[model samples]
Target: MMLGSSNAAVDHPTSNVTAFIRRANSIMRQLSSATLHKFVVKFPLLRGDADHLDRWVSLSAASRARRIVLDLCPEVEKFGDKNQMYSFPLHLFTGGSCVGGNPCVKSLYLGFVSLNLLPLAAGGSTTTSGFTNLKQLTLHKVSIVGDLQSLLPECAVLEWLSLTYCSLHCHDLIIRQPLEQLRYLRVLQCRLQKLQLQAPNLTEFEFTNQQVPLVLGDCINMSMASVELLLLSDDFDYICTKLPVALPHVRDRLTVGTAIRTEALVLTKAGAVFANLRHLILNVTIHGCPQASTGVLRLAYLLDLAPVLEELELHMYCVSAPGFPRNPRDLDAMATSPPARLHERLRIVHMTGFHGSRGQLELAHRILWSTAALDRLIMIIGPRIKVDYYFRNLTFADTGRLVARRYIQDQFPGTVITVL
Candidate 1:
C-alpha cells in the first residue's frame, strides 16, 4: 500500500519522515480491498548501502499488484534475496543483473527479462505452474540451451508465441499441445533445424530465414478454413509441391516465391495450381541456360494456365546471343493468325526490354497485328540501350517511324503509337 520514495529527498531520514510514512499507512488502511492491476516503478539509483535496497524490496512486497515493470538504473547490478520471492501476475525485469529466477505469481502475461551482467543460472528454466489463461509469450535474447518442451506446455491457451534470436538447440521442436487455439506463431532467427506445427486454427505462419528450410509435411491438412495469409520462402518447395495436391481447398489465394522446381514435369502437370490467381509476380533468374527463350515459352504457357490472371509482372534477364534474326519462326507462326475467338478476351499487353532488334521487332509486330481486341500495347525499351546511340543514329528511329508511317498509320489508322 505504501508507494516507495517521494520526489523530494530530505537531508536526512528524520522523525518527520517516519511520521509521513505512518500517515501514508493510515490512508492505505481506509482504502477498499479492490485489487491493484498495474504498477510501474522507476529508480534513479539506489543511494545508500545494501540495506537501502532492502527498504525498496519491502515496499514492493507490500503492494499486491498483478502487473509490474521495473526500470532500474544500470549501475544497480544485484537485487539480493529480497528479489527472490518477488512475484507478480506479470513481471518484466529489464536492465539489471542476477535477476535470473522466474517472477510470476499467477500467470505471466508477457514476461521479458534482460539479464546483461550475469551468465544464466545453471539448470535454470522459466517454470509456469499452468498459464491456463496466458495469451501471448515472447522470449528475446535469452540463452536457454536445454529443452523448452517443459516451458510452453502450461501455456495451453497461448494465442501468439514468438522466440527471437534464442539459441534453442533442440533435437525436435514438436508442439505436442493442440495449438488449435493459436492464431499467430513466429520463430525468427532461432537455430531450429526442424519445426512441426499442428495448429488447425493458425491464421498467419511466417518464417523468415535464408538457411532454414520450412518443412510443412501434413500440417497443411490441419489449417483452419478461415486461414488466409500464408507467407513462405524459396526452400518451401517441399510444402509448395504438396500444397496444390493436399490443400486444393485453399490453393486460390496462396502466393509463393523463388521456389526451385525439383521436377519441372511434375510441377507442370500440377495444372496451374494457382488457377484462381489474380496477381502473378515472377523474378526468374535462369543460370547457364543457352537462351532466355525458355523463360518466354514458359511465360506463354503460364498465360494460358492462369485463367483469372489480371496483372502479370515479369523480370526477365535474357543473356543469350545479343542479336536475334529479324523474322523468327514464332513470328511466322503468329502471322498465320489463329481464330478471332482466341483474341476477343485480350485487353492489355506490356513487353519490356524492346530493343527493336529483328526478332524483338517481329515479336512486337506480331503481337500488335494479331490481338484484335487489344486496347493498350505498352512496349518499353530496355535501359541497356545507350541513349547516345539511340538519339545520334538515324537508324534508331527509322524502323519505328517507318512502322508508324507505313503499317500503323496506313493499315491500322485508329491505333495509337506512344514512344517513350
Candidate 2:
C-alpha cells in the first residue's frame, strides 16, 4: 500500500510512504559532473571586502574540487591579514598584488608581482611550509631580494620552474635541495650575473639576455638530449665570451642573431662550436664588411662547421660602396664552394633581403650550382630593389628572356625557385 498521504496534520506520511519514498529517490538522483575538475576565481577589482571574502572562503573550503586558481588584485596596503579568506587544497594559485598576512594558499603561480625586502621580511615566518604538493611554478616580473636558497628548499616537489624579467643580487642560484624530479626550467630577461643549476632530470631550457659575462657555471651538468638557445647582442665579442661555457650540451637546433661586427673572430668561433647542429638559423648584419670578402669567408666557415646541417635560414644585410666590386667570381667563391666535408643533408635554403644585384645574383648562381640535392630555394627580394630593372639590365645568354630568368633556368634546372 502507498504510505505517504496528503494530510497536513500528519507528522510523518504513512498511507503512501513506500511509493512516495521511491518517487523522491528517483527525483533526487545525483547529477553528472564535468571531467575538467578545476576552479578559477579572477577578481581584477577585488578590494577584499570582509563579507565577500568570507563567502569565497566558505565556498572554497566546502568544494571537493581537484584544482583551484585564484587571481586576486586588491589595494597594496590591504594585503596584511594573516588569515586567508579561503582555504582549500588547491593545486595552483596565481596571485597579483601582495597578501599582507601569510594566506593558507600554498601552491603559487606568481605573475607581474615583485616581492620587496619588507614583504619578504614580513612573510618570513610563513616559511612556505604548506607548499609541499606544489609541482609547477612561474615567476614573471618578480624580484627576489633574499637568498633563493631559503625559498627553494620549501618547494621540495617542485618539478617545473620559470623566471622572467626578474632581478636577483645573489652570486649564484644553487638549487641545493634535491630537484631530482624537476624537468623543465626557463629563465628570460633576468639580471642574474651568474647562475648554477644542479637538477639532473631537466629536459628543456631557454635563456635570453643582454647582460655581458652571463656565466652559467657547471649548473646544467645533467645529460640533456634536446635544447634550444637564442643569443641576441650588438657585440659579437660579448656573445663569444659567454657561449663557450654556457652551452656545453649538444643541441639538435641552434638559432643565433648578432649585430654587425667588422671582426670575423666571433662568427668563426660560433661556426666552430655549433657545426654538429641539425638546424641552424643565422640573422647577421654585414654592414661594415663592405668588401664582401670578409662576409663570404665567414659564411664559408659557418657552413663548414655544420656538417650534418639540414635546414639553413640566412637573413643578410649588405651595404654597398662605390669601389666595392660586384663580381660574379667573388659571389661564386663565397656561395658555391664550401668545405668538402659539408653536410649533403642540406635540403632547404631560405634567403631574405634578396636584391637581385650582381653580387646577390652571383651568390644565388653559386648556391644553385653547388647544392645539387637542394629541394627548395626561396629568395625573398627586398621591396627597395626594382625586379624589372634587375631582369632588363643584367646580361643573359640563350633564349631572349630577362637576365634573371635565363640565369635561373641555367643554374637551378631541377629545383623550384620562387621570387616573392
Each candidate's root-mean-square deviation in Å? 12.8, 14.4
Best by TM-score: 2
Local accuracy of candidate 1 as per-residue lDDT tens digits, 145-249:
445555555556777777665555453456554665676666666666666656666654544333333433333333222111122222323433433443333
**lDDT, model 1:** 0.40
Global lDDT of each candidate: 0.40, 0.45
Name the top lDDT candidate.
2
Model 2 Cα lDDT, one tens digit per residue, 19-101: 44345334323211222234344332122233443444334423322344444322243442323322222222222111332
Clash number for model 1? 1
